[model samples]
Target: MSNRGGVVKTLFKRDFVYTFYSWGFYVVLFAAFMISSFILKNFLDGIREEDILVSAYPLNYPLFISVIVISIYLVMLSGVSISREREHGTLEVLFYGPVTAGNFLISKYFKDLCLGIIALAFCAVYFYLVSLTTNLGFTAGLVRALVMGVFMISCVVCFGLFISSLTGRTRSSVLVLLAILGGFLALQFVHAALIGMEREALSTPMLYLRETVSHLFRGINWVSPFAFLNRGLDAVVLDSPLLFGLNIFYAVVYSVIFLILSIISMSLKGVKA
Candidate 1:
């Protein structure tokens, strides 16, 4: 147990420190904040009254956009890093030490999770400045959304790692990640659109299509990180304790299941295979 503990500590420190100092993380942070600033600027511009009920408001939309943007980058980063490391013989070298797939994966998961939290901290600071400038005081809703953001990030990175574990090469990982995420987004978009329409307005074929997509969406609730994101945001927005707690529980279960699958996938494939 002590040996495994040491292994996780060593690997976590090594990878975390390296990635922390890398320019990529900082670059992503700048990009996310820039986009957030652009969004809030337009939003404030539209409502140009000083006393227009701007104070003590929720910045959920900008925050939502920022989280989605950062998540896309982090997901790709996780997938590519794992796949590339495997290709370059990094994992093989690490495995020769006391490292096993389980601890190694846990280290990766935590390293990325910590990075996500750092990004969220930057988010807090960025939004704080926005609140100060726009006189839109950050309220409890933003805080709740940020708390929900943590679990969303976990599910996202774990999903990326799971995809990476299933593929051998970095190129394959990238391709698969894009394809799968694209499909998931398409499903959500079409599903929401169809469901928003009046039931009587739909043609016979459209009704059947909506039903099919509905079933598919339900099937993917457990498999899709975006589904988790949607549920998390809904729970926070509703301000329901029951829904919020349930979302957290579901996120944890989803993350754990994916992490275990990633470890098992790596074990089955071995380093070089």
Candidate 2:
């Protein structure tokens, strides 16, 4: 038991160091903060000179944006970690040591989750500074959203690892991950559009197609990590503790299912350079 813990810790430390020492993670954080600042400035400017902007949690939107940015970076980092190790023969070499598929993938998942937590900390500090400058209230809702982000990031990391385990090359893994995520986003947009359209304006065939897409979109909500984040964020905005707890449960289930699939894939595929 101690030996297994040591192995996971060692791998986790190595990946964590590599992630922070590289420029990619910092670049992503910088971009997120800049975008948040830009949006906040414009939002503050839009208020009428005579009118006051009363917001319960103005920072929640920026926090969500930051989470999205960090999630993308960490997901890509998780995918690239496994694929790059395989491409460079590191994984195969490690397999000759005490490493197993379970520990290896868990370490990667933990490393990315840790990175996400660090990013969340940075976001907290960033938003605090923004609030100091802009008077945008940092309420309890922002804290809830940040807490929810941890679960959302677990889902993202597990999903990325699953994709990485399936592909031999780093490029293929990233491409496949992007393609699937893009498809999910496109499906969601189409479903929203269909829902917003006047039912009477649509022909019978169009209505049938819309119904099919709506069902597909509903299914995707269970599979997509972003959907979990969205649901959690909505729950926070709505102040619904029941919905928030349910979303957290769903996120945990999603993470566990994907993590198991990732481990199984790695075991079946073996380590190849």
Candidate 3:
């Protein structure tokens, strides 16, 4: 095999072996399927609309489930990847090897991405099957949902890799990953509240605030794999719609930037080790 082929094979084998042997991966898949199934069932019954609207919650059920799933996966994967290696003391060995920082990080990241793809595939397949059984056909909303799902996976993988590179301790990395994700999410809410409060009769402040907050929310939603996938699925795929132009762009750029940074950080740290 050529270099690209070799990379694929190596990454694929790693992803397949690691995820398959891990109970966590199965739990993720099972959870995703159950969530999607429940959501589909609600849609078919048409009663979901009443409950959601009556509650006045901003999130739809499927979107909410996807966000929770992606966030959990990202945090869990970050700790597992680094913590396991640290426990085995393999990270020190690998650092001393001939492997470059970029290659090493990429190999590991690719493994995470592959696992994410598999999980997302499970979500897609379940939705499809459910749709068939219920006579509810696939819609453009689902396409948006899947696209967001892929983007979210990429974001999570990159974030996880970055966290993994920061320490040899898996627990520490997982904590940091959770902190970063949670901090950003909380800040978005704070931002919306701040903006919402700036109303005045002459300023059209509330109107501007609402639109501005919505835009910011969308921006963050796209940048975060967890948030973006759900938003895209809800707005673009299922209900009141919005396109993810800048959100998509930001997400891709952020993932690339972090992946590169993680590689550089690992490379420097590896040299010291």
Candidate 4:
């Protein structure tokens, strides 16, 4: 047990350092902060003097968006990590040591999770600075959303690992992930549009199509990590303890299931192509 722990820790440290030293990490942070700041500025500017916006957590939405932007980069990083290791023969070399498929995948997951938490810390600092300048009102809700962000990022990491385990090349892994996620998002949007339209205006074929898309969107909501994040954030916004707890539970289950699948896939596929 101690040996396994040491192996995981060593790999975790190695991956963490690699991720921290990478230029992409800093770029992701900068992009997330800039986008959040831009959105906040626009939101503040839209407020008229006579109009009052009474909200418990104004920054939560921006925080959610920022976390999501960071998540995209982190997920891709996680996917690339495994495929790069395998392609470069590092994974095969590491497997000669005490490392197993589970150990490797768990270490990658933890490294990415730690990075996500660090990103959330950076997010906290960013929001604090924004509050100092703009008074955006960082409430308890934002804190809850950040906490939820950690779990959401776990889901993303595990899902990325799952995709990485299936593909031998980093580019292929990323392309596959992008295609699937894009399909889910596209379906979601189309379903939402159909729902917003007047039902009477739709032809029978269109109605059937809308129903099919709606069903597909609902299924994707359970399968996609982004959907879990959105649901968790929505629960935070609504301040529903029950929904929040449920979402958290769902995220944990999602992460665990995908992590197991990733391990199994890696084991079956072997360390090297």
Candidate 5:
């Protein structure tokens, strides 16, 4: 038991150090903050033009934008981690030690989660400074959103890890990951377009298609990590403690299930491409 614990610790420390120190992580973080700064600049400009600002959660949108940016980079990184290691033969070499698929993947999972937390910390600092300089006031809602972001990033990490375990090559992992995410995005766009139009104005075929896409979109609420993000953010906006807590619980379940699935996949697939 102690040996397994030590193995997890060693692997996690190595991965955490390598990734946390890498320029890629900070580069992605800088891009996220830059986009948030742009959005906030526009927001401030609008407020100045109007001479007044009235909103309960002014910083929430910028926070969400930043979170999305971080999630995208983290997702791609997680997606390629397992496959890249396998393709390069590092995974097999590591497994010759005390490492099993379980410890290896768990280390990778926790490493990404820690990275997300660090990214979120940067976001908190950025938003707080923005509030201080602009007098926009960093509301509690922003803090709440940041908290929810932890769970959101967890789901995203697990989702990407699951994809990583399924494919054996970096190219395949990336292609598959993008295709699945793109399909989710397309479904969302179609559902929104349909819902926005008057039902009575739609033709019969269009109505049927809308029904199909709506079902798919609703099903994606369980599978798509971004769906969890949207739902979690909504819980924060609604200020319903019960709903907020429930969604967090759901996110935990989602992560656990995906984590188990990824482990099983790695075990079955082995550490070779």
Candidate 6:
């Protein structure tokens, strides 16, 4: 096989062995699936209520679950990946390889991202199953979600690798990662507050300010991975599709930029083991 092909097999084999055979992996997979299924079932049943039916909308279900599953997968898998290597003392051992720093980093990033992508695929499956309950259908939404999710996963993996690279031990890295992740999540609530405040301030003659604020929110949405995923789907999945080609172009462009930064960051940081 060619060198690139060999690299592909080596990475794929390593990840499959590590993730599929590990008991911890199975536990996480089972729990996520079971909880997701239960929640979706409850949501479907709840839609029968008059008030709930009025609020029920397409992609609403997907958005709710995506945030939970994606966040957990990113933080937990990253922590677990690095912590396991540190526990086994394998990270230091791998530093002696013929692999360049870039190659090693790419391998780790790819492995983690693949695990996340696979999990997200299962998330998509759960989404499809739930959609069967109503007249709702999914196709374009799925494509955009998958594309955006992968891009986001790539970015998150880079963030995780940077955390892992900070020290020889994984515990410290995991703690720092959780701290950062929590802070980012809290920012979303802050955004909500800011938007509400702006609405009140612009309640008078500055009617155009409302539109300007809304447009600003849409533009700023590109920065957050979760925001982009939610916005892209929300814009396309609902009966009232808000974003068109221009908005999608913006999202795709941003994803590419984030992914490039991720690659560069990972390349610069060598894998110790």
Measured by lDDT, the strongest candidate is: 5
Candidate 6 TM-score, C-alpha based: 0.68
Local distance difference test values of all predictions, in order:
0.87, 0.89, 0.64, 0.90, 0.94, 0.58
RMSD of 6: 5.5
Tell me which of candidates 1 and 6 scores higher on lDDT. Answer: 1
* Model 3 error, position 203 (Å): 16
Clashing pairs in 2: none
- Candidate 1 lDDT, tens digit per residue, 43-155? 78767655364534457888988888878887987787678788889989988988898998888899999999999999998898888887688878899889999999999
Q: Which residue pairs collide, candidate 1? A: none
Q: Compute each candidate's TM-score over C-alphas.
A: 0.93, 0.96, 0.74, 0.96, 0.97, 0.68
RMSD of each: 2.0, 1.4, 5.4, 1.4, 1.1, 5.5
Could you tell me which 10 consecutive residues in candidate 3 have the lowest summed lDDT? 51-60
How many backbone clashes does every candidate have?
A: 0, 0, 2, 0, 0, 1
Residue clash pairs of candidate 3: 141-237, 152-225
- The residue pairs that clash in candidate 6, if any, are 91-273
Residue 103 of model 3, lDDT score: 61
Residue 23 displacement (Å), model 4:
1.6
In candidate 2, how many Å is residue 272 off? Answer: 1.4
lDDT of 1: 0.87
Worst 10 residues of 6 by lDDT: 50-59
Per-residue alpha-carbon lDDT of model 4 for 1-273, expressed as tens digits? 698898999999988998899898999999999998888877787665536675668798789889999899988988777888899999999999889998888899999999999999999999988888877677888889999999999999998999999988888888998998898888888988999999999999999999998888888889999999989999998999999999989999999999999999999888885
Q: What is the C-alpha lDDT profile of model 5 across 139-250, one tens digit per residue?
A: 8888999999999999999999999999999999999999999999989998999999899999999999999988999999899999999999999999999989999999
Which ten contiguous residues of candidate 5 have the minimum total lDDT? Answer: 51-60
Better of 2 and 3 by TM-score: 2
Q: Write candidate 6's Cα lDDT for 96-140 as tens digits.
A: 655444455566667777777776777677667766755456556
TM-score of 5: 0.97
For residues 1-273, what per-residue lDDT tens digits would candidate 3 score against the true structure? 766556546645765696769897787767766775677566645645564433222223464475468557755775457555755777667556554566666777767776767676766676677557754555556656566666667777787777777766766776777787787788687676766564563256667767776777767765555665554454553345335554566568878998888877776655321
